[model samples]
Target: MVRKHERLATAWAAGVAGVVFALLMAAVIVLVRVALPGGADGGDVTTDSGQRSAVRTALALLPFAGIAFLWFMGALREQAGEGEDRFVSTVFLGSGLIFVATLFAAAAAAGSVLGESPQSSDFGRRLTYTLLTTYAMRMAAVFIITTSTIGRRLGVLPRPLVVLGYLSGLALLVMGANVPWSELIFPVWALVLSLNILWGRRPASARPAAPA
Candidate 1:
């Protein structure tokens, strides 16, 4: 009974954390893109008050998004329990940690513009975009792929979801650097997966009793 309760609690935690992370990440990406209409490859931006404010808001929310992502990752790993394959689990853990670190690094790069010279701002913007689109998203792709693989093996995720995860991962991996706003796919995927977990979770009473 206690184990069942713990599993249920973990599932709820994963769902909530994933949703929070997804929404916050999507909001941050949108705010940043809206503020920098020229995209990452564009020239240095004039420090318009509105754009600065948007960037600031995105930066402010970044840490919370990171925190929620960490919680979500941890909860999902907990769900895997002892049945998880060591190799895939290691890749999953590594990719997620790297993605978070790169994400923070990108955020720090973006934050530099809030108090720096125009030249510094330009450099920061470029660096932020590169880190986010190139490195972070690739890591995210790996994380997604590994997660999908794990889910498939564990039978936790449905076949369609597993396929969607693979497609999302592939898009992030192949087109994230070249295609604008491709990073949004990650949050969307996360949101869908989280919703599935939440909706599919069965009540303790619904489980068949263990052998006496």
Candidate 2:
């Protein structure tokens, strides 16, 4: 009973961490979006204090978010245990790692814009855009798909959530880089998944019939 209680506590802790990861990452995206100008012209890059502050805050949050994500993954794996489908689990873990890597790459690309001359800001801005909206989102889509697939196979997720994951994954894969702010969906999905798990929506065991 004690071991089971500990496991449950760990699961809840992991769920909270996952939610934190989503929140921090979402905040970073929003802050960076607000700080950057709409026009792609490198000449428009401004090092104003507000934008700089936003970028700095975003940079500071990213490492914590990544660490939380790693913890979330480990906790989720513990929940799945040895019964999980090996192939799907492998893909899920791999895509998650790639997602974090590309996410950091995007942040670094954006950070590089800070020190550059206004003339060079355009190049950095475009690079950051491509890295984040294009590459990072693609990896996120793969992660979502694999996670949804695992959840479906394990019966650990509700049908509506699984369908929502597919839709979100499709948006990331198909409309990615083209749709502004589309990357928010990744964090939003993570929030939903974490909340659902934390709500004690575990797989049920078949109960034997009551005695007559």
After superposition on all C-alphas, the RMSD of every candidate to the true structure, in Å, is 4.0, 4.4
Question: Which stretches in model 2 have alpha-carbon errors above 4 Å?
Answer: 39-43, 201-212
- Summarize candidate 1's per-residue lDDT along 70-157 as a digit string, tens digits: 9999999999999999999999999999999999999999987676588888888888888989999999999999999999999999
Model 2 clash pairs are 42-122
Model 1 lowest lDDT segment of ten: 38-47
How displaced is residue 21 in candidate 2, in Å?
0.7
lDDT score of residue 209 within candidate 2 = 48
List model 2 lDDT by residue over 1-212, tens digit each. Answer: 99787778777977898899999989988987877756244245455778777778888898888888888887887887777898888988998888888778877877766775775566767877787788888988988888888889889889999999999999999987667788899999999999987876343444444579
How much lDDT does each candidate structure score?
0.91, 0.81
Model 1 lDDT, residue 201, Cα: 80
Q: What is the lDDT of residue 133 in candidate 1?
A: 90
Candidate 2: RMSD over Cα atoms?
4.4
Candidates' TM-scores?
0.93, 0.88
| Number of clashing residue pairs, candidate 1 | 0
Residue pairs of candidate 1 with colliding backbone atoms = none
